[model samples]
Target: MSKPVILCVDDERIVLDSLRTQLAAAFGDAYIYEGAEDAEEALDLINDLNEEGISVILIISDWLMPGIRGDELLIQIHKNYPNVIKILLTGQADEVAIDRAQKQANLHRCLSKPWSEAHLLETIKSGLSKL
Candidate 1:
């Protein structure tokens, strides 16, 4: 069976690269680290992974994107895959949006854009522990 996936969605290439590096460094090869530049692509990839029987354990997404916003994407994912842990990383997400994600998406945490690597790793570890 495939390892669980930890997906990151961000519009910025640099942000995705950073996530890839950090996640790999922290988690090693225990899980698959996937990235998508937009919500549509991420949704497609999630569906594909699901069909392939690869569990997606977590998603880290940016809030402001060109297409669907982060909260909306997480909410959609929650609708189909409630077990997946969701985290929103945003520089400018408002309280309303964060609240919506919390209620609708079971959002695990909301971290500010300039997130510390240590905090991010801790959040992921905490989320994994719950699973």
Candidate 2:
């Protein structure tokens, strides 16, 4: 069976690279790390992975993307993949958006941008524990 996936969606290439590096260091080879620059691409990836019988265990997404916002994307994902853990990593998400995600998406956590590695890792570990 294909290994579970940890997907990160961000508009900025640097942020995606950082997340990829950090997640790789933390989880090693146990899970696949995938990155997408936009919500549409991320959704496509999710669909493709699912078609291959690869489950996406977690999603880390940014708030202010070009197309669908982070919360909306998470909400959409939750509709079909409620078991997937969703975390929003944003530098400018408002309270209303966060609240919506929490209520509608079963959001696992919301971390501010410029997030500390320790905190991010801890959140992921805690979320994983719940799964």
Candidate 3:
């Protein structure tokens, strides 16, 4: 069977690279990582993945991006891909944003910035299991 796919969105390239490496190491070939600098690109990739019959089972996104806030991006994702688990990784999310995202996207969890590698891997595993 094909491996599960995870879509990770962050404006910082370093964060994206780190996540790709770490997730690959932890999961081996069990995940397909789709990284994007902004929500628009992520949306495009999600569409392509859906067309290819590969649904994104999880999304890990940052909140303070340039084009779209992480919560907004996840909300959009929920609109089309409601079953995909959504997570917000940010250091600056306010209570209002969190509340809105929780209602709109059913946000699974929020991880603070500079998250521990172990915690991240564990959270991802749990999120995927719940899906």
Q: Give per-residue lDDT, candidate 2, residue 3.
A: 88
RMSD of each: 0.5, 0.5, 1.0
Report the lDDT tens digits of candidate 1 across residue range 12-32. 999999999999999899999
lDDT of 2 at 20: 95
Q: Candidate 2, residues 4-28: lDDT per residue as tens digits?
A: 9999999999999999999999889
CA error at residue 7 for candidate 1, angstroms: 0.2
lDDT of 3 by residue, 53-88 (tens): 887999999999998899999999999989999989
Looking at model 1, residue 12 earns an lDDT score of 98
Clashes of 3: 0
Off by over 4 Å in 3: none
Sort the candidates on lDDT, descending order.
1, 2, 3
Which residue pairs clash within candidate 1? none
Model 2's lDDT to the true fold?
Answer: 0.97
After aligning candidate 3 to the native by TM-score, how far in Å is the CA of 108 from where it should be?
0.6
Q: Counting only residues 3 or more apart in sequence or on different chains, how many pairs clash (N, Cα, C under 3 Å) in candidate 1? A: 0
All candidates: TM-score? 0.99, 0.99, 0.95
